[model samples]
Target: HEALADIEDELAGLEAQAMAEQQRMALKQALSELPERTQEIFRLNRIEGMTHAEVARHLEISDSSVQKHLSKALAYV
Candidate 1:
């Protein structure tokens, strides 16, 4: 029983690492396909973990425009 628990823990860790790598690749591929402004907004909101309002303020756009660009960028990704 102890051995089985240890194996399960190891499998869980491997699965988490694989998922992280896949997400990293996906974001990288997405960024490559995005335009400069779209990439900046996505990086700020998704990678940098900023709020939409914060990204809008920094980029000098409205929050709705931020949302629009993010939506388009995600669709491309």
Candidate 2:
């Protein structure tokens, strides 16, 4: 019974990892379909979890520009 429990835990972990990989792949594919600048903004905001203001600061753009890029990226995705 103890061995069975260990195997179950391992299987669960593997399943979670696989799901995360799938999500990453989907995001990558979506980003690849976008324009270069739009993709960069999307990656910074969505994948890296940066706020719009932070992305704007890093990209040296206005916050409104970040929001625009994000909106366009989402529409494309």
Candidate 3:
């Protein structure tokens, strides 16, 4: 019974992980559907760990523009 309980716990953990992965995939799909500039800014800020200022510097855009792009990208997702 103890072994069976351990297996059940592991299964529950696996199910949780699977659900989390599905959610991540869905989010990626939504992000992919964004506009090109929005996607680039989103990737730089969110996925590549860049700050808004850094993304603006790299993309040659203003910080406010970066923020707007991120906001629109988030809204679309």
Candidate 4:
């Protein structure tokens, strides 16, 4: 029973890894569909953990623009 439980745990870990890979691929495809600037904003805010204002400052854009881009990116995803 202990061996069986160990196998089950390993299988669960593998399944989780596969699911994570699939989701990563899906996200890549979705990002590809977005415009370059919007993609940058999305990456900054979502991946780099930047705030809307921070992204706007980094890109030399307005906060509203950052929000708009993030909204568009989120909607696309």
Candidate 5:
């Protein structure tokens, strides 16, 4: 029974990993459909762990613009 439980846990972990990969692929496809600037902003904020303000500062754009781009990206994804 202990061994069976261990196998079940391992299978659950594999299923979770597969789901994560599928989500990643879907996100990538959605991002590809967005404009280049929007994609960059989204990546910087979401993937690079930058806040909206930080992304704005780094890109030399207004914070509002960064928020707008993120909103658009979020809507698509």
Candidate 6:
């Protein structure tokens, strides 16, 4: 019984991992479909662990602009 329970738990973990991978792939596909600058701003903040302010500073844009880009990119995703 213990061994069977362990196997079931491992199988559940694998299934969760698979679902997460699918979500990740879908997100990447969505991002790829966004406009170039929108994709860049979204990736800088989401993928590179940058704050909206940091992204805005790096791109020389306003923080509100960065927020708008992020919102648009999330809509795409």
Clashes of each: 0, 0, 0, 0, 0, 0
Clashing pairs in 5: none
lDDT of 2 at 17: 100
Query: How well does candidate 5 score on lDDT at residue 68?
Result: 97
Which one is best on TM-score?
Answer: 4
Candidate 4 lDDT for residue 13: 100
Candidate 3 TM-score, C-alpha based = 0.90
- lDDT digits (tens) for residues 1-77 of candidate 6: 99999999999999999999999999989899999999999889999999999999999999999999999998778
| Candidate 3 per-residue lDDT over residues 8-74, each given as its tens digit | 9999999999999999999899988888899999999999999999999999999999999999988
Off by over 4 Å in 6: none
Better of 1 and 5 by lDDT: 5
lDDT score, residue 38, model 5?
100
| Alpha carbon lDDT at 5, candidate 5 | 100
Q: Once model 4 is optimally superposed onto the true structure by TM-score, how far is the C-alpha of residue 1 displaced, in angstroms?
A: 0.7
Clashing pairs in 4: none
Ranking of candidates on TM-score, top first: 4, 5, 6, 3, 2, 1
lDDT of 2 at 67: 91
- lDDT values, one for every candidate: 0.93, 0.92, 0.94, 0.95, 0.97, 0.94
Of candidate 5, the 10-residue stretch with the lowest lDDT total is: 45-54
| Residue-level lDDT tens digits of model 5 in 1-77 | 99999999999999999999999999999999999999999999999999998999999999999999999999999
Candidate 3 wrongly placed segments (more than 4 Å): none
- Candidate with better lDDT, 1 vs 4: 4
Which stretches in model 4 have alpha-carbon errors above 4 Å? none
Residue 70, candidate 4: C-alpha displacement in angstroms: 0.6
Candidate 1 lDDT tens digits, 1-77: 99999999999999999999999898898788888999999989998999999999998999999999899988888
